[model samples]
Target chain A: MAEVRLTTPISEEEIRKLKAGDTLYLSGKMFLARDEAHLRAIEMFDEGKELPFDFKGLAVFHCGPIVKQDDTGQWHVVAAGPTTSSRMEIFQDEFIERFRVSVVIGKGGMFERTTAAMKKYGCVYAAFTGGAAVLAADGIKKVEGVEWLDLGTPEALWIFEADNFGPLTIAIDSHGNNLFKDIADIAEKNRPKAYEIIGASKE
Target chain B: MEFAPIIEKVAFNLMKYSATVLPDNAIKAIKTAYEKEKSTTGKAQLGAIIKNFESGAEKSTPMCQDTGIHIYYVEIGADCPIDDLGKFREALTNASRKTTTEVPMRPNAVDPFGSNSGDNTGRYIPWINWEIVSGDKIKITAFPKGGGSENMSTVKMLKPGVGLTGVMKEVVDWMISAGGQPCPPTVVGVAIGGGADIAIKIAKKQLMRPIGEPHPQKEVAEMEQKLLKAINTTGIGPMGLGGNITSLAVHMDYAMRHPASLPMAIAVQCWAARQSAAEISADGKVKYLHHDIKD
Candidate 1:
């Protein structure tokens, strides 16, 4: 697995070259949004309002982070680990197509529909280590700003300036290889053997 | 005894510490798993997680952004004489509020169909579970349950006849499917033989035990070992990136139930596995447990 460092607004060519199992350390610009922010994004589309920022060739992280404000009122990202992506499976295909996101970073694999979207739309889903919140925050160089404050802190849109922002595993690649799905098949095949080792079975 | 102040201060520190630092056992488990993991992806994943915990402690920042909703297991002494019954509960609420600023906790509490309170508190924030103990001391444990792992927790009612095999199968199946979602290399807690809600509640409580501590019952301890190995062989690995280990430990607690029923609940805690324990004596001397608080 080749480890590559890339900035945001990554090219379609760069995404296409990546494969499942590759490790990536992304830097530069990326955005964070979770369940509610996605709702707001989609709602804006419904109302024909422009999204808060340019979406083409960008990275969107699925996360809700802990950010603290200093006496000078500057915000610091305290913890910023990826949330599970499976919860957003319903919105992802549309999100990818609508936003032209080349990279979607989160943990917990999404389903086949997402895999299809990845293949069809030239996007890739990467798995950031789950619960490595502070580690992820450390890679974030700055908090550019946030959006949708009314949606609460956890659900707001946080844009970050990053440097070596991840040691993310490409769980799903544009080529349609799904590490999450493949692992399940391996586990299923290994199950009966495991059951046998435990002497656990129907009598 | 005048216990309110002690409780409030203890709860506040515990919340901050647990959020920022991985419990000692969790750190050891990750280090051990990193060494044992053979695959490059799995090793790197485990290594990154280990560093994450280290940096969290260094910066005094939360190990995970979620920091999770707070749940406490409190043991109150029956013989202890505290003036106000409500003071303990009030302490929990106040501590939660105070920690929100000091820990700078993200306000995760919401009204479901409504909105967030932004203070991490509302109806039943920092949910507390109480039990009466024989000594004149109160012991409190704080566990932060992240939404990712909490969402994967399961409760099931089996027809008793499926017996042990059925139970084990269901357990392994969930772990396999859950994959990296709940954060693999997880600590699994199983509660067996209780009512529907009791099964789930006790399962969450069972997770409070330190990782790798075996149950006293020989049968249960043996089963825990077997399941731990079983799930690890699935190759879900660290962060589900394909290593040899998927679970650091599997804990199961049993209780009496109706003869025909086998209600089981699976409580999943992510690799962060944050926990803090403290004891307040009747005279009000407080001591912390599980993890250190050195500068």
Candidate 2:
């Protein structure tokens, strides 16, 4: 219920102290990477190819932003909301284990394997509200750098400097608590009630 | 009269408006959700969503990063001055390309195996559905479907015996299973009684309606109300973090079906619910129907 301020390079101790329902406003550095970038980063790590940026203690955002360049050719984030994190579930556990990222910022929330990884690695999944792109971009003070433009604009990795970048709800904490899963469990219990209300049965 | 230029301009404007501005009703629904949300997490999510759209309108930026794949529903007049329908298609395509740069929409069209088109256009991209109707004007609605919600859309063929109860149960079960993936506080469009493809198409089309607008038929409206209540009861809430209000509304439509088939489709529109419309007269005057566009 408390609003916490997190600045990267966030520490494992700091992330461990956070709880599942707390609100967080993050500042400092965060990297935007979605599906393609996630795969590429992991592949690069496995292949012993050094990635351009070190993810240590930084927030990994699940976002494919709408960025534009001015006449001066400096890229500006037009919209930068989080993409669905569940899509990254396959690589997230490994991404966390290999990259040492402290915070995973995204929408929707990740599932069991990623939650287990967060528990083991002291990482937290903080969910920015889905579709809050302009607000997210507003917090991004500058585009520090970009990589893999060949993957197309949306799939490229954008390095951003952020200031008070969220009202992120910690949906999964380092303590094995998962808000999304809890809600799903509740929905499962209520499913029969919904069916009863509709005078129907799933079968 | 040359209609291509007018159509191009109108389509471009609609795409821009939809990307940058949340429709009035969608904003209203989110406000209501914010007020009614009991959980702190859900409330914060709703509050952020409200601020995002407000900021987007002020700065003229996209409300979400995924500006979405362009989909248009066109109602053309039989007596319209436009002689060539192919030109109309070309104009819409051109409009999509223009909006990509001008609104600076994210280039969302990507080939499954290859790469992004970078222009929000490609083979069968900017998919348009046409209906020939009875006026000298064409009404176009731009409904850009984002990847997250679009991925959650489904079509299922239930046995005819399951009937309305089956449809209701199926929807509730699916939403519960979908969890936060489609972006909760979604506007769910449920279509029944058509073939599999028609059901899916109709289901998506139903999303063009404003949030919480009831279907005109008494029985259909009742169905919507019941489904809405049932969906909210799940406590999936905003962004599926938990609370009341999993969905803003459940819009349902149906068609006559073959006796042996009972097909249903679920189309979800995320909280952004970006859509806009404009009517182009034969004389080329653009009338904005959905939002008040300031020139």
Model 1 per-residue lDDT tens digits across residues B79-172 = 8788766788889888888887788887888888789888778888879999998988899888778999999999999989988778888898
After superposing candidate 2 on the true structure, give the runs of residues whose Cα lies further than 4 Å from its correct spot. Answer: none
Candidate 2 residue lDDT tens string, A1-203: 77899899999999999999888999998998898999999999999999997899999999999988999989998899889999999999999999999999998878999999999999999998888888888789999989999999989999999999987889899999998899989988888778777887544
lDDT, each prediction: 0.86, 0.90
* Candidate closest to the true structure, highest lDDT: 2
Cα deviation in Å at residue B246, candidate 1? 0.4
Q: How accurate is candidate 2 locally (lDDT)?
A: 0.90
What are the per-residue Cα lDDT tens digits for candidate 2 across B1-295?
A: 7778778888898999999988889889889988989987788778878877888899888889889999998999888888667798888899999988889999999999899999999999899999999989999998888999988999999999988888888898888888888887999999998799999998998898989999999999999998988888888888888889789999999999999999999998888799999988888788998788865
- What does fnat come to for each candidate? 0.82, 0.89
**TM-score of every prediction relative to native:** 0.97, 0.97
| CA RMSD of each candidate after superposition | 1.6, 1.4
